[model samples]
Target chain A: MQYDFEEILETIKMTEIEHFDIRTVTLGISLRDCVDRNIEVTKQKIYDKILKYGKNHVKYASQIERQYGIKIANKRVSITPASIPFDSFKLDEFVEVARVLDKAAAEIGIDYLAGYSALVQKGMTNGERELIKSIPIALSETQRVCSSINVASTKAGINMDAVLMMSDVIKETAERTKDKDSIGCAKLVVFCNVPEDNPFVAGAFHGVSEPEVVLNVGISGPGVVLDAIKSAGKIDLQQLAEVIKKTVFKITRAGELIGREVASKHGIPFGIVDISLAPTPAPGDSIGDILKAMGVEDVGAPGTTAALAMLNDSVKKAGLMASSSVGGMSGAFIPVSEDQAMIDAVERGNLSLEKLEAMTSVCSVGLDMIAIPGDTPSTTIAGIIADECAIGIINDKTTSARLIPAYGKKLGDYIDYGGLLGKAPIMDVRNLSSNNFVGRGGRIPAPVRSLTN
Target chain B: MFISYFGKLKGKKVKLSESEIRAIAMQAINELGDNANPELVKEVVEKAIKNSEYVPIPETQSQTTGRVILTSFGLNHPGIVSNVTKVLSDANCDITDLSQKLMGDFYTMIIMLDISNSPKDLSEIQNDLNVVAEKMKIKVYLQHEDLFRFMHRV
Candidate 1:
């Protein structure tokens, strides 16, 4: 036999028992050429291009899923940032573009279409400012379009003005979709040093430098890693890291194979395989469980950051060895709502917003999928965004805030969107003001590390 | 003989006649004009040859090994293997290897098959096996062999 009996069984066990699966196979279609002087023409071109490349995206992905036994969780699309090519559009025009994107996504039968975005890590162009202003209305009106704004980078410093505006935008989006428990906010991300080829939606965009069309895959299997840890009981930290690297290498290889096959089917270029340990809400498929298995009592425990740092490092090391094309946020994600164990930790008061912020410094992304009181002031949100940006800039890693200030929801309440977005408990926030600091509204100059070049 | 000689010159198995080769040279000359050096002429000739003979092979041809691993397990029954093999034979699938083990009253069987020559694709064969498994109250999983090789091998 070409494969050992145990090897065959292990492959089956990963898919059937552990929740090992490709998190997303995002088809990135560039809309750089879709711009036109007329807003209607621009919308039509965007819709047509997406349809031409993406009409069979879900079909091809499902076929590949069946061919292999591994399930692909999401078949999504990302486009060139709207504010880039269509820089002449106003707020209303951008909103119109978002609606057309929603229609195209629905037509092609994908759940989310990202890249309704602007990258203003330095300063905003007039169109970028207008597009940022239109996010609340666009998100409120469209069911499947997701928006992100890059407000800071290590080289460009923190764009304090953009951060402040995004804070207000997040608040307004939360209020606009308050009827659905601020679901609009759930579809928005404020990023620092966001990756262009990221396959995960809500933060994914077809970076300007990316090719006309590409396929990137995000692989998630925290359950597989957790199982490996549980089975490797009593091993020291170094030995445990070996176990994680071995398990992640196998999964990342499988992810790359699947990604290449899908890209071949689309007749497009395969981009990258993001080896992030993204957890779903499914039982036993939680990153928090992995941390617990690493001997942390709960997520907010004192040793949590160390454990996450080791886990994130081990994942990256293994991914690098397994696939040469590892990009995006290639570490562990700790989204509060998307992982069941993390939600349980927050509810039990074992995890706090502050601890999540700390954990983000060592992990893939920052303060993801967290719900706070609706009345939490925009300045406070700006403060949180700035703190995350500070960590990202100093460390020179990608950090983002997908915060849902659940409108009219307070502490002890929950915002449940169910199925992948899962549910987030509204956690307590400090009432301390940042009015004077954020009100200054100037770029935080690039840190000393930016002098590396 | 002429086609093979020309194919050997280009280092590709693409068939071309003497007249076809002359036409390609003529086209390259017309395209490149006076700037054409020997290296540039060779490059244009190769591209023209590729364009003339390109058939756009289906994406699946290069990726698929056409080998699949079919694993089925359920409570021990009288004709479990027969029913599964019947479907494979009907689909023109060539079973390369087979193994089975029975622990107590439950049986697990793994079959390696080369379905390259099959009239039906993997999905259709899977659907056919699914029907058989449903009738027999067994669980069947058909996956491409590359998945296992990629995961288990380096």
Candidate 2:
């Protein structure tokens, strides 16, 4: 039979797809081995561990990137919770470790450093309690160190008892560092069965079960999927979904290939693939395209709920179908500055923190890259993070918040974090409000409803 | 035939719109099959009508439906249609079943899909699959008869 081969070719050509590559492969290294009776020996061991393990990480990551045609964006390290070594009176050990990690990160070309953290759930351990008391002085001395204090968990239920104490700890930490610009307060998170292989920070403490040397891949592909979905116009909803599924499959294949090769070359086991839609203030690839595709003119409008639900569903379905092993908060992100569309939405008065919270309900990570007023109280910021984490705990999904309270910046003002933090316009907060409820520092007890299950 | 409606012949001329003329042609065509030729075509024409505003109704007739054949190589790297059709021909499976999707090293193909009359179960047809798979070092999985239909609902 005679046939139109060209028309058939055109149909196959319609499947246009691309990927943004995995942005970061963070290795969570515990610094417990760095402790010693002698102060200088402790500092040297910290330096030695970072220098030894981090030496070949970036080199091997680059080689894998070239072989698989996938870009490996950042190769960094997050150590064991730094609060353990801070049980001293002077806080000297904390500053020493921070300086060592900063130097090691610079030498290895890793952009981010994390794991300056404290855990105070159900009540702080003696070491943890002391570390929490000295957060302000230690944070001020470190150049690149970022920290977090876990004050609650779903498994252990609400630690309202501990959270109440944490309120004062957070307040004192926030106040003591008022004069220092670099020392920012990001010390609040809720861990709901935290993963050992999670590479994203500032909550990336080396979990107990994880290996000393394992390759954790953080895959980012929002731009590629958004582009394909945008091109599939006038199609039925089911057909649109199929196109997205195919796109995600192809992108994930690229990530898996790269991850396996990275693991092989480094002689480290291949970790999980985090199929998250991480953004970087770039044009065309922003999460806003997804919202717009869902028929929302502005991202944070009343229709935002339906819009985000559709976006997250498609992303999760496509990612799951694409790869066998998927981990991390593998969903579409709505960070304000990291995404260009989100940044523009906030500046244009089309997006607000409340609307963002509504959108984050459907996203993997909650309230990420949000910039609130500098004068915003630590309790209020903690409350925002708490609300976001509560959604994660209840839903049994991974969620986190990374809010930047730009010092000396008020409502309508903007701060440029220059590179990866991008730049964000200060968003308005609810006025005439006191977080007196939050200030009554103690963990909110986990819901009694969960006990039945 | 100068037939006209009795009340409509009030002035100098009477005219039918293009649609009305086409309607007459269509009626003649339907009544006489393909034999309605030049004379029927001429009778359908009328003089220009006022405004001549008319919406033409589309012809309603049954036409042949198009078919898509999904063909797969299953196990080996065969030259598209030639080798895939050869397998069907050998099995006497006819051209009814076909879809080809190359996932990784595995060459999978499904044929439009009427295999009910075949003398073999799907497993029997998949026996010679080893020969192709060993040649390519890839396993071939088959979805025969009602399997594809049962699988993809959307």
Candidate 3:
């Protein structure tokens, strides 16, 4: 195809000015066939498949990044949820398998490999139970491995049992890595209706239904969108949304092009384009910056949810228009720790944990990368997850909570994840107890679409 | 017939901007029908060269081999280019292209370098570049070509 000179220049300008980047190129490798009665055999199979499929993925990603003059920010590997592959393994064996995944990822220079995960939305299988139990040690001991648990879905209703269990797991994970300000909690995510082919961590895992190997791309362009909004200067809400949609179309188109090329190069089927406006710690690249550009002085002010709802829908609309294979969690990500502006807002008391939770109902993921007080009860954590999950269940949307109980750190303290994870201000959580509410642990029952809330 | 062809393309199959397609169309028209005198061409070329130091007209698209684009962002200051390029030249890396512009106080410069013949890997060279960036109180991003293509174009 003939290249457009202006478009080429526009790209150079975007890269130079805006922090536009292909956020991640994640290769989802399925390990369903790795299951064996002998856990050792299963572990070997997992390692062998990862090494075989992942050896040249990062090498190719780097080469392509250079060849195109675009930044491929991260190269990752997502495997089928480990729980499904080792239903017979004990807790320590699950830890051992997580070690194998972690070691293989490090060997291949993968930024993060996600799969120390389980799907227990309805109820927990023995395998899922063991994996959930093993998560505290598995995540605390590993460097590059991320774990996610799905405990609720619209179709299957809310799994209150799994929600309570995952809440306890989060606390355990925080306590085990307390010295590093609960860094392990940062790597662990609890989800409701998680996307099967998401490329972003710490919620990415190859779904049971996905192909054996697939390449999924997550495109990030919050800075680009925010720049567009700023240049258009105080337009009506409709026009503002139009600006976001057009910008996202351009971003998603670029993502589709790169994703297909990468997939073709690897001889693997291409998966969806997750057009999430993922932010870094850079000055201009922030979701809070985008919100402020939309005239919200504070990110979590009263109209924030409405603004977020519009932003999220506009992103999805443009993404679908730009790519035929748009899926995953394609919306505005409001992860508190990753966004510098959000962290600033929280520190200044303009944003709070409750507001963040409310915003998640309208955005992509749920209460993400939020650091609550060290003394916050595990039941409170479960209560928060249950609330987010209830929202996801009713709306038939994906929601997640990656709350870090900055162990021994209070609301005023900050935990520095460093690099892309950014710094998180420990925001105050409501002291209202929900232990009895979560204690009635069954399912929250499916939403009645006929009776909309 | 040629005019009609373009007219139909306006409503139907033309994906490129009219100007871009027009450039190609004009070139085709000249190549297919026009005749030019070699003597006149040579005389004009020689006259232009005699008037100034011989600067070769680069091909429409410059060929790139193992090119890395490094962008430096910071408050505008003197000698930014000279100092940064000095580092590259000292490392024996060839600067294939350089462009810079100032918008307000922020000076952004993009340098495209040929690193195929470099003695050190890009990562090691980035460390050296980082030192210069740190000293200048600027952030320098070294990126590959895909970043530009994947961000800007479909």
Name the candidate that leads on DockQ: 1
Instruction: Give, for candidate 2 chain B, the lowest lDDT window spanning 10 residues.
Output: B145-154
What lDDT is reached at residue A296 by model 1? 89
Cα RMSD to the true fold for all candidates: 5.8, 29.2, 15.4
Error of 2 at B69 (Å): 29
Off by over 4 Å in 1: A450-453, B1-63
Tens digits of per-residue lDDT for model 3, B101-132: 78899876777787878886566677788899
Q: Please give the DockQ score of every candidate, comma-separated.
A: 0.52, 0.01, 0.12
Which has the better lDDT: candidate 2, or candidate 3? 3
The chain A TM-scores for the candidates, taken one by one, are 0.99, 0.86, 0.98
Give one digit per residue, the lDDT tens place, for model 3 in A385-405.
Answer: 999999899888999999998
Model 3 complex DockQ against the native: 0.12
**Candidate 2 residue runs with Cα over 4 Å from true position:** A1-19, A84-90, A133-140, A160-194, A448-453, B1-154
Which regions of candidate 3 are displaced past 4 Å?
Answer: A1-6, B1-154
- TM-score chain B for all models: 0.64, 0.37, 0.55
User: Model 1: per-residue lDDT, tens digit, A1-453?
Assistant: 888888888888898889999999999999999998988998899999999999999999999999998999999999999999989999999999999999999999999999999999999999999999999999999999999999999999999999999999999999999999999998999999999999999999999999999999999999999999999999999999999999999999999999999999987889999999999999999999999999989889999999999999999999999998999999999999999999999999999889999999999999999999999999999999999999999999999999999999899999999899999899999989999999999999988964666
Which of 1 and 3 is the better model by lDDT? 1
- Full ranking by DockQ: 1, 3, 2
The global C-alpha lDDT for each of the candidates, from Candidate 1 onward, is 0.93, 0.61, 0.83
